[model samples]
Target: MAKNQRRSVTVTLLYVFFIINQALTDGPRFVEPIPNVTVPLGRDANLPCVVENLGTYKVAWIHIDRQMILTIHRHVISRIPRFSVSHDNAKTWLLHVNNVHKEDRGYYMCQVNTNPMISQVGYLQVVVPPNIIDSLSTPSSVAVRENQNVSLTCKAEGFPTPKIMWRRGDSQEITVRKRKVAVYEGEHLNLTRISRTEMGVYLCIATNGVPPSVSKRVVVDVEFPPMIWVPNQLVGAPAGTDVSLDCHTEAHPKAISYWVRDNVMLLPTKKYGADLTENSYMAHMKLTVRNLQATDFGNYRCISKNSLGETEGSIRLYEIPMPTTISRPTEVRSQLHKENLAKRNVSKISQEERVKSKMMSSYDSDEINSHREIENRHESGNGYHTPSSPQLSGCISITRWTFPQFAAVILNCFFYHCRV
Candidate 1:
């Protein structure tokens, strides 16, 4: 009996020793392989650390130099808002620092713990301040046609919200004119929309409002100041007839209302009477081209421009009673017409009639061509053949030109119109 008891005790002792050896050799598993990181002076940063099979052992974070223990499991042991450490799903641990300061630049350590075993430690780093050496000065001046509204702006950038103030170049002292200048951002110093009268050498002051104010001088030039607006067409008339392209503009102290031909202005005269309207921005000059010839093909930008500045916009005009074969010209004439449009010297009423006639004619051509194309395709079996393959499992019919590319274009046009 004594010998049997001795054997049993020996076996039990061996089994316990084996288990202890395995536990000592195989410690907790490390999840993330990372080096200690260094961060900037004033920025946000995160340090990552993780351990697996972390069920029993608690985790700890300690700042080396500070000797301050930062975290214990999910509980952040630091009172400062700048310090926080959290373990998500018991997998990885993170330390987040906010709005870092220069003094905050230092090393941090991540430590893991388990019963009956030594702790594991990791490191982190932080860096601060940035290079500040660059020039900041620029505002381009431009000539604008008189009697038009203009907007000018100044832009600058820096660390720690740079102060931005605009001063008229003509003024000896940099004064903030309430209506003329207002700060878009107190920090970066951005100004939006200054009028032509506000154009001149202006100073941009960037200071934390501290001792030495850093100022970048900029000159804002208002360019080509012209005033133009959409014109209303003349009294009712039937569709599909001759049409005129009409536009109007005026300038301060009145500028010549002319059609911009390759950047030059054409005045209405004998062949075309000038349709003029007077306004503070418009020069009371309108153009009406009679007989509206193809030679007049191009854009007509109503230019109410003088020596001060010039500005213009485009109005689309289409051909009336267009030929069936040329229905889809691939490109619309309205935009292209702006580049080399004819501005004959003509009255407004006639110009209006001309435009009406052209539009009606184009619409009529579109309808007839669409009907004819459908009929022609239907008459030919090959042209109107429907896909019979199961791969194309959908119903298709005649009388409609449906294809992927055409469908995309239609969708795009629909969206564009919606936006407009």
Candidate 2:
């Protein structure tokens, strides 16, 4: 019985030794291949290297591009502050790169210290957002004269080589080659023969496939001298009346505008007031002359001045006589013609007959009574008055009236009495 037990124990010992030898010869093996990693710039990245059956073996991480070892086992070997190493369950080794940069992009290898030195490589892609280079790009503000050529340039840097676009800051369309477009794509935006309409803020945008694109504002100022436009060169107003004269001007650099009369600058006062309204490059200037007198009538000028130059527009102010109750000869004739037209029926009376009949009817109503009251004192025995009489001696009765009305009455009477 003792001999049999000894043999059985020896067999058990051999089986145990065989198992230990097999475990030792197995070495380390990759459980899964390392997967490629993509991380944005300034972010952390974790590279996983899973292993199984590892016995007395150490895992390592290497930068294949630089041929530098980054980590070994649970300890970090790279001098870079962002490099770190960690493992879970002694099987999954993780290599950490914090705050990744463009220079950190390349191939990374997860290696195991084995008889044959097994390793697996993965690509670490670091993507960068767009960044504008101010020193090499257009300035924040640029000034150019009108009808001059100008160019705006933009420069950018990124991992994917950023694209550039130019557009107005006000969200308005840009004029390119005489064609209006909502957006322009190019590093350089050239404008030939620029005008005041193009003076405003412009946007320089740089973008790539990466998130958080960048942009800059460039102010394009168009400068020009003062130019005046006069709406009315001649203005007439009667005495004791108020009048307003206006002048429009366009200029850059914000021109100073004022009103001038006889080389004297007009100020704001009770008798005279001056006003100026401005809108960017355009200004509206007004001069109000209150209770105008004879002395206030003269040539007045609206003057505008800027750093570029000066310009002036003139207006002539003249006095008109005060109105009276008496109408002029032309006015009387116009009235007579209007009355004749009003008395016309749809049948349309003849012009001569209408004129004679209208004048007689008006005389009967407005002059007949006055003529009768004075007829006795001015009547002579021959039923006619002398030439000096106030009542005109004509076939039609005439009374106190303007010379035009009296002459028209006599002419119509002659035409009616002598009709063929």
Candidate 3:
């Protein structure tokens, strides 16, 4: 019973010692400083504050910018629904900002209700994506006349101040300030003396190193009168052949293209066919004439008309004479050989005639003398003449014959007379 009494007294002494120590060090003091937080807009943010020895002392959060208390202990003081506070039950306090907005970005204070009223400050950063302001920006579409100056404007709003750039939607180059560039780094794009070639969609891009970069499209329309270019102004084709005449036209608001012949509109038919191909602002006009006749050779007009003006191009269709091919010597040689074969089988020729016949058979078909002799034979009677006759026989001229040919003729005559 005495030992049990001693043990109880010792436990009472240790409890008293612990209570005295708690009374000496029982005050809320920050153990870890608050850390700055950065979060995107519409996201939650948590600012932590750690303290030690907090014994019944109230912990509070304050908005340094507004100089207002956000929370006290576990009760929220701010009426804003998005502001709240929590703790780890052991000295760590958290300030919660739900669905943070731009106004929430500022310095936040983690405070403690002590004799000295200790506090620490942390910053809250809220970032926002780029957004284009259409009210202050250029319109969706802009119309201008040819050779006129034009300007495009862009406006945007975002955190960190968005940077604006200009570019062409078609990925083509832009002429600005007497220079050409793929991208123009400015809020305004200025064009001087704008032509049809410079008309297209212009894009205004805004970014701030954040997600969801945005852009706006502005269309630039340039109006112009109708103009035409004739690829084949003077087309030549032979009779009974096919020919095509072409004309290229450029205009705005689309253009009507057609072909006119002798003040009459030419329609699609078996002999005359008209066709048109169109691009954005350019058109190709073609007229086809099948089985060209003598009457088809004339001037044809390609006409293009638009809301601005009308233009026409003239093309002259002329006849190109077809090439004439002369018959080859082989055909003439074949005819001569056929006639010589008939003469040899039908009647017997004299020795002189035989010599002449052999020479004629071996003659080069290219020589005109052979053809002339054969023609003379057909004109004369029996192609022969007697000694008393004044006319020469239908044979190769003796003056034109070679020495070998003359000797052969002489020998043949001599032998023939000897035999007689």
Per-model TM-score, in order, reads: 0.27, 0.71, 0.72
Model 3: lDDT to the true structure: 0.85
Task: Provide the RMSD of all predictions against the true structure, rounded to 1 decimal.
Answer: 34.0, 16.7, 13.9
Give the higher-TM-score candidate: 1 or 2: 2
**Candidate 3 lDDT score at position 394:** 27
Scored by lDDT, the top model is 2
Error of 2 at 178 (Å): 2.7
Positional deviation of 376 in candidate 1, in angstroms? 96
Worst 10 residues of 3 by lDDT: 386-395
- Candidate 2, after superposition: displacement of residue 194 in Å? 1.2
Sort the candidates on TM-score, descending order.
3, 2, 1
What are the per-residue Cα lDDT tens digits for candidate 1 across 346-371? Answer: 45657867865665455446545655
Model 2: runs farther than 4 Å from truth?
1-25, 320-420
Assess candidate 2 and give its TM-score to the true structure. 0.71
Which is the leading candidate under TM-score? 3
Tens-digit lDDT track for model 3 on 190-291? 999998988889999999988889999999989898999998788999999999999999998788889999999999999888888887778888899999
Prediction 1 TM-score vs. true: 0.27
Query: What is each predicted model's overall lDDT from 0 to 1?
Result: 0.55, 0.86, 0.85
| lDDT (tens digit, per residue) of candidate 2 on 96-150 | 9999988899999999888789999989999899999999998999999999999
lDDT of 2: 0.86
